[model samples]
Target: MTEQPPPATRTQAQRTAATQAKVLDATVDALVELGYAGTTTQEVNRRAGVSRGALLHHFPTREALVVAAVSHLVDRRLVELLTRPRTGHEDIEIIVEAFSGPLFDAALELWVAARTDHGLREAMIPLEQRVTDALAAGCADLFGDRYTPAELELTVELARGLAVSRILRTADADRALVTRLLPVWKELLDRHD
Candidate 1:
């Protein structure tokens, strides 16, 4: 009989990175499911199925973990936006889809929590600015010839408002409503052309 090969072992750095990624994924899930006040280290540990010692070793504090998770999320989002293939989609469609997702839900949770928590507010400003700046840059690049800068800004604001409305929406119907409204919004932009 042929001998089976031994399983590949992960390096120390790789193990640490895997642990950190698990923790951050749990952190974002907690924020989206339970909001800021509900996302405790214990909860993250529970969700990640990692031991307390491991959790503490990776993230010594709840604030540190939250900020790191948000930073990680923002970095991922920026990469996605900048690297996405140009498919000639409408500006409103791209912008709306960007703002409507689990990350947006997690971010909204942080935004609400940050409004009251001074430390979180301090950490979130730069992150929020980065997202806003990326959105603006993406809009300019995608639709600069067709839409004015002011118009793009308006669309962004409107998309944000629409995304925020998702927080209290009734799910399927509201989603359909938002989808239908996208074309209506694009038509308004077309009117200016």
Candidate 2:
């Protein structure tokens, strides 16, 4: 056979990031499908298709792995929230709609589990605060002038509540109370503006 060129190599950081993403994404998938108790490192490793050594190298314990996954999921959504192009209006819709996805489902699982699991709660506190801070800053930057600081904070709170209440929805079209309230909130905001 003719001589072939060597394959291009990824940097160590790239390899590390790829492995972490695989693991974290798998963890989120498990959380959404299995809930907190079901999302063990074994399940995560299997879902991620990575060796136990690799998973342990990055995340020593189940709690560490879980918290990291929560952080990863929220950060992924934040990038989408912050980087996407937007028109002059649609701020409320965008903010609320962003929360109505897998991140909300996964985070909801964690929040419920954290209530009694002291270790998980301890690990989750900083992650929750970090996510909140990042979302606050991102909303301020992306939807500036459309809402005052208080309005933005309240809007984010409303969106969070909407996401939480969405669990009560039975059918896809059941329209959780928050889903109905969002349009009214948007209309009121539009009238105010």
Candidate 3:
């Protein structure tokens, strides 16, 4: 026998899900193309092919949409951070590379916006915390029980400071900065290991 179709209610739910996805995709596009401060509700709505009312219905405020975008970016970065093959079978380099790659780019964009845009920073702090926690947890998992919780936290903080410095650098930028910094961090981890 043939199966029955989804109920009309299910179709409506699916449509809502699809629309929400589009809105989020548009938000990211606007973010990349326009940067966070330049992104507007109208632009996002136009790109998303949703009505202003629909955008408002889904996101309510620009602040809400920006926060959603930050959360989305962080979640994707966390997955990449956790799954990266241990580079050189060296967790330190892998960790540094993870920060210095797309995750770094994302943070750089957000940091510039977060500096002058109060609304964006307000939206980003919690998402930042989650990303930090995930990376620290990964470090602990890599180091096993040899590293204490305090040391793990310090390592995470140092990584964050490095990331921020890379984002905020004015000149003399080079990839070696991250690679160089990793050894100092590795030394700390080594003492505990």
lDDT agreement with native, every candidate: 0.84, 0.85, 0.72
Which digits, one per residue and each the tens of the lDDT, describe model 1 over residues 20-138? Answer: 99999999999988988999999999999899999999888777789889778877876787688877764677788778666888888888888888888888888778877888887
**Cα lDDT tens digits for candidate 3, 147-167:** 687876776666666766765
Global CA lDDT computed for model 2: 0.85
Query: Candidate 1, which ten residues in sequence have the lowest lDDT sum?
Result: 86-95
Q: Count of backbone clashes for each model?
A: 0, 0, 0
Top-down lDDT ranking: 2, 1, 3
Q: How far off is residue 89 in model 2, in Å?
A: 1.3
Q: List where candidate 2 sits over 4 angstroms from the true fold.
A: 1-3, 171-179, 187-193
Which 10 consecutive positions of candidate 2 have the poorest summed lDDT? Answer: 170-179
Error of 3 at 167 (Å): 4.0
RMSD of each: 2.5, 2.3, 4.4
lDDT of 2 by residue, 51-156 (tens): 9999999999888999999899888888987777767564677777777778888888888998999998999999989987897788778777777777877888
> What's the true lDDT of residue 120 in model 1?
84
Give RMSD (Å) of candidate 2 vs. truth.
2.3
Better of 1 and 2 by lDDT: 2
